[model samples]
Target: MRVVVVPPVPALLSRYASLTDPVPELRAACVSAVAWLVEHDDARIVAADDQARRIGEELLAQGLAGRVASASERIETRIETGNILVMANGSARRSEKAPGHLDERSFGFDSEVEAALAAGDAAALGGLDARLGAELLASGIGALATLADLTVTRAVMDYADDPFGVRYWVVRWECAS
Candidate 1:
């Protein structure tokens, strides 16, 4: 199994894009990460809400277009099977400019989440407090928790940053069946 983790940054959607990307590197990383998932024949998406799911779908669509254009034969698109694409992110209170404003606890909260993701510590992720995550404006805890039982064989951090006070990550995990 393969999994890709990304944030539901509206800027990732072309409709929300500005003339100049506010997050150039992040955007590139997201596109690249989603493209990797598109390599699979199908995928299941996990997100916090409809909007987030839409973002994931948009990314998947973009990836599919690219893939189809390069493929030798027609590609079939399906849903809710194969690799997993999770739309999630850490705290939004890391700094004064953060969406939830500065919270001294945000740093530690984000650090723990980041560590879990980087190490593919499914137990730690599953044990994360949903309430605390909400208080800290973390959006990925629920989805991460669902990964508790998966045995991750490899974890790669394609991107990690707290730009605009919102912690975002693009990580890929290869899990054993």
Candidate 2:
């Protein structure tokens, strides 16, 4: 199974298009990852909330050329496990100019998450501190927690950044399901 973890930032969606892409690199990573997920046509999105869900759907539409899948519709098309698109992000307070302002604790938290993704360690990802994540304005700690069930055999991160003080990661994992 293929599992992809991407930030839920709305700026990546076409609806939120600006004069110039605010997150050009992030958008590129997200689009490429989504394209990879849709190659098998078994992408299932796991979002933290309504906003995350929207971003996932928008990404799917972009990947599939406007062919977006509803949750029920996607389930009906497959009986076995398939690709996973996890909409989550780390702390948004990496610097003084960050959305949540500078929080020294964010570095530790984001580093732990980055390490887990780089190592494909689900156990470490499962143990993340949601309370601290919330205090630091992490977008999808719950969604990241849900991904603990995945048994990854290999992991590759295509992008990692905190451009707007929000920690975003685009990671792909090969899982043994």
Candidate 3:
């Protein structure tokens, strides 16, 4: 079954980055956030079918207990039939029916995904992973030891044209269990 799975917002990591200046914390957040993506089979939330939605919800449930975003950031998760979309905006909206261009203002998952794909740099993924990992640690989730344990499964490009301006990449990571 096909699914449109939106990646989770690494709320914990983002908040931690603002509160602290430690590099290890940032790296941990990066690993944890990307590792979560790996478990989902390198999914980029564009749309979803019935089976996909169910699967997405089950996966997201695992991370609910460890939310790391601040009050203002306010991350949100929702499942619709076969479409699972997670965002920090607290609003639910389907991808454009006709498939239009993605604006730079499109939000977290899409923007990052787009930029990552455009850069086509493996190093960029690692860099972002490091940054996110550090952010997560600052948020007080776990140590770098945990993030380092994650395994990156696969990386793929879900490409589309953007009318906005700059292109982006959406790198996926699979962690070691």
Candidate 4:
């Protein structure tokens, strides 16, 4: 099975579009990821909340546009029925400009999550402190926690950053059944 995780950043939605894109790199990552998933395989979306779900679905729909954007820059793969799309994010308070404001703890919490994503450490993801994650304004950590059940064989971190005080990641995982 293939497992992928991406944050549901509000700016990615079409409703929020502007003349100049605020999240070009992030949007590119999301589109390429979803395109890869839908090219030959259907997917299941897992999100901790409604917004995440909506965003995930939208991204999925975008894949139907049948545009890969670039042949060399994005992934190319045959797909199957076992692809998973997870909507998740780290703290919303990585800095003072963060929506939740700088809480200091956000740094550590985000770091742990980032590490788990980069390494495909499902155990570490499951071990994340739920209370602390909540306090730090982490989005979709619940969905991420659920990923512990999967036995991952490999992981690739496509993107990682805390733009606008919100830590987001684009990750792909190959899992063993």
Candidate 5:
């Protein structure tokens, strides 16, 4: 089975850094983000197997609540030379007036974390998983499973006030060659 796992986007450094704070709000946001994925980001997700797509559709449908609006969104998946790119896999507020934009920001890693990914250190990556996971959880986003294949990602979760909101996250996973 071909599976694509997305972990937390890396750009949310400040929001996620404070582990001491009790971030009940962030945890709830993570759940909503998952459900949002199924609803808004289906088009970008691709699986060579039809069964995988079917499963994805089911999960997406189940993610919707009565309050969530029906979206005409799509998810895209592309295979590059040594990595896989999964993008446009979440919600966005498409208003012309206040088009909340999100950018691909690399993880502002401290020297230690930087050295690890740069040097292909597995232990370093594992260490990052713990630290990053805590940060993500603090930001109302949860870290999903980390793939054995080394994939890095950068994404943004941007939104305005209550009624209209835009939130999304993406993670790049290296597929076994």
Candidate 6:
């Protein structure tokens, strides 16, 4: 199984794009990750909400040249060959310019999440405190928790940064079948 993790940055969507990409590197990373995910005919998106889900869907539509399966949650349970796209980010308080402003606790929290992702530590990812994540403006906890059920054999960190004071990562996880 393959799972790709990306941030739910609105700037990634074309509708919210600027004349000059404020997150050029991030955008390239996201597009590359999404393109990889859509290599298969189908993909299951695990997102925080409807908006996040839409971002995943749009990526598929764009990357796959409009060939996209209707987004469905049940497809994951029904198929074993498709990819999983997780739309989540670490925190929005990594710096004073961060969306949630500077929070002393945010750095530690994001570091832990980053470590887990880099190490492919499912246990650490699953054990993340959802409440504390919310407090720290981390939106990826729930999706990370779901990874506990899977066995991650390898993790490829395609991107990791806090460009807008928001922690973002583009990672690909190769899981055991």
Q: Roughly what TM-score does model 3 have, to 2 decimal places?
A: 0.23
Lowest-scoring 10 consecutive residues by lDDT in candidate 4? Answer: 71-80
lDDT of 2 by residue, 22-72 (tens): 999998999888878777666778887899988988776677663455544
Best by lDDT: 2
Candidate 1 segments whose C-alpha is farther than 4 A from its true place: 69-77
lDDT tens per residue, model 6, 1-177: 788898888888889988898989988887787677666655678888898888877776665653444444434442444578888898798888889998888888889988988888888888888898899888768988888778889898999998889999999888887
**What is model 1's C-alpha RMSD?**
2.6
lDDT per residue as tens, model 5, 1-177:
122322223222233445664433433443354454443233233332344344334333334332245432322221222222221212222233213432222123223333432343424544444434233221111112132244334323321121222333322222233
> How many clashes does the backbone of model 5 have?
5
RMSD of each: 2.6, 2.8, 16.5, 5.0, 14.8, 3.2
Per-residue lDDT tens digits for candidate 1, residues 13-126, read 888878889999998998888788768665678899898888888877777778777332322344546688899998899898889999988888888888988998877888
Residue-level lDDT of model 4, residues 86-170, one tens digit each, is 9999999889999999999988888999998999899888889988988988988888988988888999898898889999899
Window of ten residues with lowest summed lDDT in model 1: 70-79
Indicate the residue-level lDDT of 109 in model 3: 34
lDDT of each: 0.84, 0.85, 0.30, 0.83, 0.31, 0.81
Regions of model 5 farther than 4 Å from truth: 1-33, 36-43, 64-67, 71-151, 154-177
Which number leads on TM-score? 1
- Please give the distance, in angstroms, between residue 6's alpha carbon in candidate 4 and its true position after superposition: 0.6
> Across residues 1-177, which tens digit of lDDT does each residue of candidate 3 receive?
122212222322334344554434323433444345433333323322444333333334433324433311221322222221221111112134312323223345334434543343323333344333232221111211222223334434332332222221223332234
